[model samples]
Target: MDMKLEVVILPVSDVDRAKDFYAGRLGWRLDADFPIEDGYRIVQVTPPGSACSVIFGEGLTGQQAGTLHGLQLTVTDIVKAQEELASCGVEVSGPFRDETGAFHHAGDARRVPGAHPERASYGTFAAFEDPDGNAWFLQEVTERAPGR
Candidate 1:
């Protein structure tokens, strides 16, 4: 048996605003915008080179908008990715990493400026949020761990 992740449904306050942020600002591919009725709708978009998609709109999930966090996206170049997002008007923060010389540490850990030592894959990170404050992280992964 196999289960493959396909989409994430995000609760958003304004459907058009969320749609604009994801599809217009982030440059994600707008897969659909279907209004099933006067009060229900579905909007879907997929990030570049990502198999998973994001869905948001009216009458969807009951969770509060902007409540989601810690969602991560893997990229080959952290700086380049941040630059792209910044250019798109997304308020991006970081290219930071835990100074522990290993995996990330707990809250308030010492995060030295810039990318990780030797630019190790999966060590460097940056963050941004959607219009609804749904946070997303960008992890620089030049090489993937075995079986990932």
Candidate 2:
């Protein structure tokens, strides 16, 4: 059995606003935007060079917008990424470095995993939230290990 992640459903109260935030502000590529029955709209956006995309729309059962938390998007440069997002008015949490020579969420500076003397295995990262209050993280990592 094999499984691969493809999409993440981000619940939102307003589809168009979310679209503007992700696509217009964040510079994600808008892949799809159409309507489904029951007056719901399906909108999908993918980060540049990313394998997984985020899906958000209406008519989802028991789903409320702005409830997502702890989603991470890894990149190659934390400072550059933070600058880009800040340029677009996104509030970035930090570019703080830990004792392990890695930068991570300043909020978690004191509580790194395993005392590995290195940043999180994923690399340097930061945190931010969308207009809908959906929390997200940006990680800066080197190239993946072979066979990963």
Q: Evaluated with TM-score, which candidate comes out highest?
A: 1
TM-score for each candidate, following the candidate numbering: 0.92, 0.80
Instruction: State how far residue 59 of model 2 sits from its true place (Å).
Output: 1.0
Best by lDDT: 1
lDDT of 1: 0.88
Error of 2 at 103 (Å): 11
Q: Count the backbone clashes (under 3 Å) in each candidate.
A: 0, 0
Distance from true position, residue 55, model 1, in Å? 0.4
Q: Quantify all predictions' global Cα lDDT against the true fold.
A: 0.88, 0.77
lDDT of 1 by residue, 32-61 (tens): 999999989999999999999999998989
Off by over 4 Å in 1: 100-110
lDDT of 2: 0.77
